[model samples]
Target: MLSTKCPNACIRACHLPAWQKAEEDVKSLLKEKLLPALQRASLKAERARIHNVIGQISGE
Candidate 1:
């Protein structure tokens, strides 16, 4: 059973048994590894964008 607090993204899995196991495995990976890597990549990309903008403003 899923609580009302469940994220909208995960709501489907709660109603579908076929998706439940795969969802759990993916969630574990996201917690243990994938989410951190994704966050790091996002930060790196944002940093690069900021640097580029600054360089353009400064005529680098």
Candidate 2:
């Protein structure tokens, strides 16, 4: 949604309370830590698909 709406400008985030330091900390954690972790996990999940022959016996 951000990309579609703000194509002319860069993506913006709200980092209120400049002195809190938590804003920058959270951003770095997301970019450096969580991003890669989620990407890898997603790839593994994508590669995992059902490739078997099975049939369920209904009303058994």
Candidate 3:
């Protein structure tokens, strides 16, 4: 068995087979879930910045 503490806690949380499965799960979630959420948040921030710039230009 492999185990460690500190920053390696994440790595130590799984053995070989479990790690492989977890890697796939994490990849799937990042691609299907996290990426979309991040994209939406980024778009919102960009829109807010554009709105702020427009407001400044209009002297509001």
Candidate 4:
């Protein structure tokens, strides 16, 4: 969940021309944005795994 209290510096850093100009900016963007999205996805995957394990244990 993105914090309601904005990280203005991070947000600014993400938007800077220098940040955009960096060769690794795409990777940086991914690290800044997609990483959290991936983490959330991983959490969901783990939850599903746990649910499946419980279901199997319960013979469901």
* Top-scoring candidate (lDDT): 3
Compared with the true structure, all predictions reach lDDT values of: 0.45, 0.33, 0.46, 0.42
Q: C-alpha displacement of 24 in model 2, angstroms?
A: 37
Task: Show model 2 residue runs off by greater than 4 Å.
Answer: 1-35, 50-60
| Residue 60 alpha-carbon offset, candidate 1, angstroms | 8.2
Residue lDDT tens for model 2, 1-60:
122224673222332233124434443454554467777565444333110000111111
Which consecutive 10 residues in model 3 have the weakest lDDT in total? 5-14
Winner of 3 and 4 under TM-score: 3
> Residue 5 in model 4: shift from native, Å?
38
Q: After superposing candidate 4, which stretches have Cα over 4 Å from the reference?
A: 1-35
Per-prediction CA RMSD (Å): 17.7, 19.9, 18.4, 17.1
lDDT of 4: 0.42
Candidate 3 off by > 4 Å? 1-35
RMSD of 2: 19.9
If scored against the real structure, what TM-score would every candidate get?
A: 0.40, 0.24, 0.40, 0.39
Error of 2 at 40 (Å): 0.3
Q: Is candidate 3 or candidate 4 better by lDDT?
A: 3
In model 4, the worst 10-residue window by lDDT is: 1-10
Prediction 2 global C-alpha lDDT? 0.33
Flag clash pairs in model 1.
none
Residue-level lDDT tens digits of model 3 in 1-60: 232334454332224455455445554454554467766566556555444433443342
Candidate 4 local lDDT, 1-60, one digit each (tens): 111134542322233344234424443444554467766566556555444433443342
